[model samples]
Target: MSAPSSVPLVVHVIDQLGIGGLEVVLVNLINNTPTDRYRHAIICLRGATDFKNRITVPGVSIHTLGRRPGKDFSVFRRMWSVLRKLRPAIVHSHNLPTIDMCVPAKLAGVRRLVHSEHGWDISEERGSSRKYNMMRKVLSPLVDRYVPVSKDIETWLRTGVGLPASKVLHIYNGVDTDFFHPAEGNLIPLPAPGFDLANRVVFGTVGRMQTVKDQVNLAKAFVELSRLRPDLMERARLAMIGDGDLKAECESVIAAAGLTDKTWLPGARNDVAELLRGLNVYVLPSISEGISISILEAMSCGLPVAATRVGGNPELVLEGETGLLMPSRDPVALAEALATYMDQPELMQKHGAAGRQRIEQSFSVTSMVNGYLGQYDQLLGRQHP
Candidate 1:
């Protein structure tokens, strides 16, 4: 079922609606955005996960094009057909995976085209590849606007991609404070059957277990923390939630360190909010990021954060304020940061409280939805009332 043609449709194109930070933002936007304002739909170039059920809106559908890896020109033709049929007022693509969809969207007559850059440029780590930049420049005319989730990404668009300032804007990803609120924590029986984080200064992270996210390094850091200060390890526990290709590798590292009993690596989970509540400190070890929604959600749940100083992380995490920052891919540095929290419970609580306050002041779901909807309004030639 679809919304009546009387309502404007906004079609979002992405790689897949799997369990990731980018997907979390998309779900939040769709669930919070009022249906009366504009109808929404998703076109997964690959396929979606059960996470799609998290969407609460009506008349929204997730269509998969079964994209073949390496090269699949058919995806554009399929996208073209879908957009022509949907007749969306706006065609919004997410990150590099879906940016090329704008061409099909334009050919299908979508008047408004949006592309949100949820991570660093794919041209390279430094985003200095001339070929990829040229490709992006050639496609710039097709995109009406680019939404970067962090100021860092916005800068990249302006400087690295040579995009005009007028066409680029930064919008911070928001958290559901009401849903991710602090709780007494149920780590004893929540995360697993026999696992218990009771009385332990739990440091946890909730994201895909992949190379980019680099959860293995977090495991190594936890091991390093234990080796450096056995007393802190006795009072600390590590929980790595979510599952991906690197999950087995992380488990292997934990097993090799002989600390499997002290850590909980539960694969994919639906009780993320509850798990976050159980944590005293949240850690993000990604090599790169864009205002991590996990950090925002953890902060909303009154948990201090220890994140890699990369991308929009620095923007959201004020060093010595809401959280601590460390160099990415360095387990030793990450370990030192975690030790500070484990040794000082008072610091964790203070920083956690400050983090929650920050969310209330700047990163509420209302503000994020409004920021995006304002862009949609501008592209549609309407005023933001």
Candidate 2:
């Protein structure tokens, strides 16, 4: 299954290509890799959304299996057929659902099989599912390498899923600092409608409006903060970007709280870098996370963060230095964390500078791309450790 030296083909498998941290990293990896050394393709087990357009690299093939609603066993057969034709030198699957293709990939004669665990859903947030663990055990021998986006996920692989520590590689997700850097004054248009760039101090978070993201909690906290601090309400605003199944519910929470005007709920957006530049404080209230790319982007944009102390958030945000961390799902705690910035606006500037410095020192996109390339070369026997 060894590919020719001219250009090795690598196929990435994922549940879907949509607005997410993992998808953003995948796009960056492909766009940054040299075209002369590697060619790329993608296989979406379910289907790909318009987010597929983000891949600016030319000559990359995209395919979809169109999985059905429940128990889509046929996708494995389809994967086998596709892999037989593509004959990729390496087949890399992402997250839980995409891990099913590893066996089919090995059977189809792929040169190497790699799997990545980015984050988890509510049901199996800790990767402790017995069924999934059994499945991983059955497929473990076939996988050449395991890539976890964060150390938390790597620990789950070793302790919860029974993976050998030697087989797991921890790669921190990186941000494109150059693209997400702070803007000059009020140059970028404010994302929300009512906020004036000159007077308003905007606090924001970007991600899908899902239950795990807890945008409803953010709405509740924003309302409480507005009620408690009437003096700051005139100039304070909350912007919740990115849409999901919970968008309507989150809007309902805001409207019910009688603070619809104080909050802005923009559906899925593409101009995140511009929006991040205009934010005064960044907040991530997710009940669960796995090294959020939005957090890194916000930090890179020179904004202080107030994120829930869950998953790999603590790894990115140093408490009281880059941003404040609080318990998840508690509106009071979230409001208080946001209120700290509203109280002493100077801390935002101080911590924001520290956050930008942190990103420059540790989470540059070049570091992430090189980490993946090193792993690929190691598994391909092109590099000796």
Candidate 3:
């Protein structure tokens, strides 16, 4: 497709290019947006990572501020200069760390400002903290529109931060159903050797190996299930795809339970959609989420999910239909849910098919892209109408 004659450039400002849900969405937006109507750019507050390789668009430019560890005012100063130079029509910032970008974007005379809250940080200011809520309250006016990816985040912005409910726009994260869809006629390959996919029931999950994702609990749950039904050790396997600080801890738990052979920890992977198609069942054991894109990817690949009942998971998983919901940090409950899927293959297939249907209907990449484009048009009309 050729570029538009007068495209509006939208610059996405992110803290870092880490492998996470927010980063994945930003990449998708850039790659999938119509070149005819929108020109996109990315500005990373911290220096960019290999994640930059994922953007395939030819003209999309990526800039970084190269800020150090501590709080630095100079980073914002540099960001202001970049905004002035680029002169983008929209400056869109993601999550908390880069929320400060709005200050610079505003000062640099950018007319439209957007901020998206992906998920809460796990530090002392974890989602429930009053101090963080107050900070959001103060920053609300700086953002022309507050885009929260889930209903839970909208509630937090309204009640927790005291932001006007009207100012919050709920936009669920979209998955590339075309990219993540189940392959036809053996098109997608299986997992690597020793990670057998022949007769075993594979339970897979993909996310950062971080505290809120709770990979440790997922490992313990797999162990407990094995203890309860030793035969499942031969019939069921776990596939965790991603690397983080908790990898060693999750590995130690599997080793202690003699599940080193059954569990496959294949660090960061690029072929996530293909990986989702190989699984019999998918799980997201996150303590918090803002409409998990991985969950949507699994659904698009026709896999039944078993995720924690937190954040926007419930909005995606239809309990008994798309997948089961278990409480966070409860290994026994997770195991029991897994056992149900293992024991009843028909139910698993039924739910998996339902999930795939849901994605085709509601969560397709086209729908997600259109939603954002519609929002942008609406914002533009408001400005120029």
Between 1 and 3, whose TM-score is larger?
Answer: 1
Writing each residue's lDDT as its tens digit, candidate 2 over 143-166 gives 989998888888888888888888
Give the alpha carbon lDDT tens digit for every residue of 50-126 in model 3. Answer: 98899999888889899888878899899999999999889989998888788889999998888888887576233
- In order of appearance, the predictions have TM-scores of 0.95, 0.96, 0.95
Number of the top-ranking candidate, with lDDT as the measure:
2
Clashing pairs in 3: none
Per-structure clash totals for the candidates: 0, 0, 0
Q: What lDDT would each prediction earn against the true structure?
A: 0.87, 0.88, 0.85
Task: State which candidate, 1 or 2, has the greater lDDT.
Answer: 2
List residue ranges in candidate 1 displaced over 4 A.
1-3, 121-123, 126-128, 184-198
* lDDT at 100, model 3: 73
> lDDT of model 1 at residue 68?
95
Model 2 clash pairs? Answer: none
Between candidates 2 and 3, the one scoring higher on TM-score is: 2
In candidate 1, how many Å is residue 197 off?
6.0
Model 1 scores what on Cα lDDT?
A: 0.87
lDDT of 1 at 377: 88
